[model samples]
Target chain A: MNANIPSEVLPILLILIGTIFSLLSAIGLVRLPDVYTRSHAASKSTTLGVLFILVGTFLFFLLEEHYFSIRLFLGIFFVFLTAPVAAHVLVRSAYRSNVALAEESVQDDLKDFIHTDSKKTKDAEVNDTD
Target chain B: MIEIMLICSLIFLTLSIIAIMYRLVKGPSASDRVQALDTLGINIISGVAVFSVLMRSTGFFEVILLIGILSFIGTIAFARYLERGVVIERKHPK
Candidate 1:
């Protein structure tokens, strides 16, 4: 196989950008003050990083016209589907468990859910016995 | 030249791993540590992908698959535990 720098250049650039983004995400994970914010860093940046890096890999192998380039594509596909779903599940679970957030967390919408649900359950019991 | 770039990226990834380790060790809460570990798994998956490219082999893809499934399971388990503080089924109240 003949070496082609131009064909590989874009992939290299992509990988470099991905590496930087991933590093930034890791830093954010450390610096973010609460679990909710840290989940933002862990989920969003890392997802983007993996996407860019996988694109890099896909381009690198596809340029070479290798048969196994299919695997990279598959990896990219799986990451895209799973990353955000996992993040959502984790965050919802955290909220359900009443994980404390920083005082600066300007909103408390879930408090309403907790209250409304409890009231619904109590009303159900009253109706059942009446 | 490609090998050198790959090595440099690998080093950056390692540094990210170190930062993640610091977070894991110093995270103020269990939730924080769990999130860090989740990030760690993703990083390791990408690192393996890089190595597979550098070696011109596809064997590492299987490892990526394994890591992906295991990490997903682990995250769910941790989420369940965080939500209820238990990993097993609760006995029915008599």
Candidate 2:
């Protein structure tokens, strides 16, 4: 109710910073050259952004409304668990499917490993359909 | 004054979503579109959080979790489909 309280100010500050983070992630997504780099921006920055934003809301409700929302806390936990995993899964698929990396990218350590890996799996898939 | 700040944040979040949408539509590869969808889900979650805070209510909490779960599952499924052209993994073909 009272914005003058120092604790109250913290939540709003967090919300604003998170908004900036999300905005930056959006910019990164639009500007990045490859899906991998874009995933980096999307997963890392947006995870931080959403986490901070949710934490701000949780604190706001706890302090101002005298409420403790277990759901909000759980939401925080779920995002922490899932964002990176999803990004990794997507990039893995992209690489295996031969989606080319951005030309300027510096290294290709997974090149040989993925070649052997996908071949075995591709053979198994051929059998599965038969 | 607080309401104004929340509104401004909402505006910024909307802009973020729109920028992402361009990538979703024009992305050269399916993987790019999948990544865009994941980011879009995150933005929606943040937007709902801001709107909930502005409303001064706790009701949007469930929506946040639901979207998170669905986005995660959808991303995983798409990734699997892209990798091996299979999502459910019916058999290993021993």
Candidate 3:
């Protein structure tokens, strides 16, 4: 394929950036102190990492082969939409299951909220019994 | 030059996957393992994309899309199962 300088350079640049982000995310996964923090690293960096790589691939095919792909676009959109929601669900499930926070976690606002809500439900149950 | 860069990047990606696998094996809690698994899925997607580019083929686009869908569904299912003991429920009229 005959290509100009910018056309050739951009995909390489994107791939390098994507690979670095993916590596960093992996390191964060291995080194983070807790599940919550690890989820942060895993979801955010990896999403972006995959995005960059997909974008790079799209551009490579577009320029090198003069062909456009709808699948790549769909993949990009799907990853962007789903990755964060999946992470949120994972963390929320962990919290509801009473996963312990790190020792460095100083405050828990959800604890009081949950306690009061449970008490109010119990009171409602007693009044119904009466 | 480009081929060499792609090769080196592939090596780096493999190492990163190995590092994530370490967490997958060593995670103390179920959520930790799940989180690592989610990250592993994303890593695999990136790896597949890079591999397709390196090989100058577009046949793997469908594979990338399929992995993304399956991983998201798996993460949601695991999260629901963890939040409650059941992933699906039947409702009865009162």
> Whose lDDT is greatest here?
2
Better of 2 and 3 by DockQ: 2
**lDDT rank, highest first?**
2, 3, 1
Candidate 3 chain A weakest lDDT stretch, 10 residues: A1-10
Per-residue alpha-carbon lDDT of candidate 3 for residues B1-94, written as tens digits (9 for 90 to 100): 8888888888889999999999999998899888889989999999999999899999999999999999999999999999877898655324
Model 1 bad stretches (over 4 Å): A1-3, A115-130, B86-94
The best candidate by TM-score is 2
Per residue, candidate 1 scores C-alpha lDDT tens digits across A1-130 of: 4567788789888888898889999889878888888888899999899788878877777776555556566678878888888777788777776678887889887788875875797798689667
The clash count for each model shown is 0, 0, 0
Report the TM-score for the A-chain of model 2.
0.88
TM-score for the B chain of model 2? 0.95
Error of model 3, residue B41, in angstroms = 0.5
lDDT: worst 10-residue window of model 3 chain B: B85-94
| Candidate 2 lDDT by residue in tens digits, B62-93 | 99999999999999999999997889775444
Relative to the unseen true structure, what is the C-alpha lDDT of residue A129 in candidate 1, on a scale of 0 to 100?
Answer: 63
Model 2 alpha-carbon miss at residue A78, Å:
0.5
* Best-performing candidate as measured by DockQ: 2
Q: TM-score of each model's B chain? A: 0.93, 0.95, 0.95
| Stretch of 10 with least lDDT, candidate 2 chain B | B85-94
